[model samples]
Target: MPHRTIELHVDRDSVAMGDDVVSHAGVLSAPRGTLLSAALELASPEIRSPGWSWVAVVDGATTAVWSVDHGVQLLVADRKLTRGPVDVFFRYFVQIDPAWLFDRLAHGVRADRRALEEEYAPIAREKYRAELRRRERELDGRFLSTECVDTLQHFGAEITLHADVACDFTHDGDAWSVRRADTMFQVFRGGGGPIASIRPHALGEAWLVGMLGASARTAAGRADLPDAEPLPGLELTASGGRWMSRGATVVQVRSELAARVAQLAYGRSVADLRALLDA
Candidate 1:
C-alpha cells in the first residue's frame, strides 16, 4: 500500500524536443511544505528518506521532475521547483466532456466549441462590455466619434482570463508569496528532524478525491448525495494523525496517517524508504 511514484527518467542521449516525457499516477501525502524542505536537505546523493512518497515523472534531458501527490500533479520544468507548500485544498471537482468529441459534432464549429465554451465565455463577454462602457464614460465625450472603437480596443486589453480550475483550494496567505519562496503552512512533527518544505501536486486535488474513495463509507454516512454537506473545516477527523489543509478548500484533513502509510507500501521506493526510515 505504499505510494506509487510513476517515474519517467530521461536518458543522457535522449532528444530534448518532441514527446520526451511520459506521465503516470501514484499516491503520496506530504503537504507541500515538507516536500520542499526535504529537497533542500539533500545533497547530490545523500540517501535520505524519500521525503514523501512520490511518483515522479522526470525528464531525463532537463532533469525536470513532475510529481503527483494528493491527486495534484506538478510540472517542474526549467530545473525550478516550488519552494513553499501550497496552502490550497480542492473545493470540488467537475469533469466535463473532452474537447475532441465536439470536433465530430454535426452542428459545425459552434457545436464543437460548446463543450467548455460556457466555462467562462459569458463572464468574459460581460466583463468586456462593462470595461468598454467604463472607458467611454471616462472619456467625458472628448472622443464621441471614436468612442466605440476606443471602447472595444480598451475592452480587448482589459478582459480577464481564467483557467478551468476545478479544484478550488484557498489559503489565507498571499498566492504570490507562496509561489515565489520556500514556505511551509504547517509544522512537521514527523520526527525526521526539521523538514525542508512541503510540496503539493500540480494536478487538481486528487488527494482528497482518493481519500473520498478510500473513506466512502464514512463520508457517505456523514451525509446524503446531491445535498451532501461540505466539511465545515480543513481538519479531517477520521483515521488518526491530524492534518490542516492549505485552506478551506481542503475541507477534509486526515484524522489519521494510517491510510497514508498503507498507500506508500504499494510503491517499491516508498516501501524501501519506510523500512529504512523505521517510521
Candidate 2:
C-alpha cells in the first residue's frame, strides 16, 4: 500500500530550552520533486528561515514543507503521534507563561526510552548480554581513555546510556586481558585503539579520532562527532559470522553489522559510490 511520509525540521533554539524533538514549525506529506519548495512558498511569513530544514516523502509522489521563525521559541508539546503518519503540526507564540516545552521534552524522552527498550531489551537479554558485558568491560578498564571519553562526549551521540556492567581483567603491560561472561577482549592501550569492534552476534562499536576527513564533516553534520577528522578503522561485523582479525589486537567485530552501524555513526553507507578517496 502507498502512504504519505511526514517529517519536521527541528532546532534547539526554537523550543524552550531542555526539550526533546520539539520545534517551532513543522510540515507533513510526501517528499518528491519540488513539493517541498512549493509548500515553503505557501508557508506563513513569520515561520520561515534557513536554520532548520527537513523533507517528508508520502506515498510515491506528494510532498510538503514547514518553515518557522528562526528567532522565536516554541515549547515542545509532549504528544505521541499516531501509527501511520506523523500527523501533527504546532506553532507557538513569542511570549508564553507556562512551561510547555519542559513537559513536552520530558514526555518525548520517556517515549523514546520506552521505544528503544522495547526493541533492544530482548536482544540484550536473549542474545546480546554476555557479549555486551564483555564490550563494556573493555570500554571501562582499557578502552576508557580520556581520548575515548572526549570522542564519545563530542561525537558518540548515544541517546541513552544503559546501566554499567562489571567484569574482571588483568592489565598485560601493553593491553588489558579482560574477561567477560564467556569471552575475552584484549583491549589495546597506548595510542592506537579499536575504532570499531563487533561480536559474533551483530553487536559492535567504533571510535573516530584524528581521522575521517570529509566523512568526518558529514558525521559532524549529523551530530555524531564533534569535529571533522580522518575516518579510521571503519569497523564492520555481522551476527553468526566468523571473526576477522586485522593482526594487531583485533577486537573481534563481525563484518555486516559493523558496516550498518558505521553508516549511522559516519552518515554514509558502505556502498558510497560518490567517488570517495579517503575516510
Candidate 3:
C-alpha cells in the first residue's frame, strides 16, 4: 500500500472580537475510503464557553446544523469521496459563562491591587478602588484576551484523516542510542507508563545482561539476582534475551549502560539478554 498525505485548508485565522461565533471555510483532500474526523480544543483556564453548534453549508444554502456537546465528531458519508476534493463551510459559537467571567475579573483586580500597593502605598487605596471600577467596565463588554486568542489559535478546528492502508513501519536504527535510552529511562522513572511499575531489582540476570550485559549488576550481585514477580499469565524464564511477556529486547547500549540497567531495574523488570546471546 502507498502512503498519501491529506491536507486541510482553513479560510480564516482568527475569531472576531466580541463575537463568540466564528466562521470557517475549508477543503479536505484525501484518498477514497479514508475516514475523517474534526475536533476543537477550547478548554482554557481564562475562558469558559458552553456547547457549540455546527452547520454544513452546501450549494450556498444551509444543509444541516448539528448541536454537538463538544467540537468533536466523525464526518460520515454514505459513499467515499476519495476521487475528488470536498468543500466544507461551517460556523460554531460558544456561550461564555457569566460566573467564570466574574471570577477572572476578581482575580485580575486582586493582582493589580497588590502591584499598586507595592509601588505607591499612599495612593494605593484610591487606585485600587478605581482599578476595580475599570475592571467592571471592561467586563461589561464581550472580548477575548491575548491569552485566549493565542489559545484559540493553538486549539482551533483540527481535521484528521485516517487511511485504510497498511503502514510499513520500520524502527530507526538509532532508537536505542544513548539519548533515546536516557529518555526512555527518564519516562520510566517519572512513572509515565505501565512498564515503569515493575521493580528493576526483581528482573532476572538474563534480561539485565541483555540490557547491560556483564557491565551491570544488581545490588544482590550479578550472578544470583532474585526472580522478578511473575506477570499474570506470563511464564518468564530465568534466562532469555527477550521479554517473554512483551517480546521486548534491548537493542543497543553505550556509556549509559549501567544507568539504563539501574533504571530498568527500578522501573520494570524483564527477561535476560542471555536468551538472545545463547540463540
Per-residue alpha-carbon lDDT of model 1 for 148-243, expressed as tens digits?
222222222121211121111111221111111132221112233321122232111122222222333244453211222223322323433444
- All-Cα superposition RMSD per candidate: 27.0, 20.6, 23.4
Better of 2 and 3 by lDDT: 2
Question: What lDDT would each prediction earn against the true structure?
Answer: 0.26, 0.33, 0.30
Worst 10 residues of 2 by lDDT: 201-210
Model 3 spans with C-alpha error above 4 angstroms: 1-9, 12-15, 18-31, 36-49, 58-78, 93-279
Candidate 3: C-alpha RMSD after superposition? 23.4
Per-candidate clashes, comma-separated: 39, 33, 10
Which has the greatest lDDT? Answer: 2
TM-scores for all candidates: the values are: 0.16, 0.22, 0.21
Q: Write the per-residue lDDT of candidate 2 for residues 1-279, one digit (tens) a residue.
A: 533443533221344355445544455443333233443333333434443322222222213223342222222322222233332233332222113322333344332324434544455444444655556545644433344334433433231222133222222222222122233332223335442443311122231221222234454464323333334654433446633444332445334433433343343322231113123
Give the per-residue lDDT of model 3 (tens digit) for 110-181: 213234334444454465446544654555432222332222223221111111110011111111111012
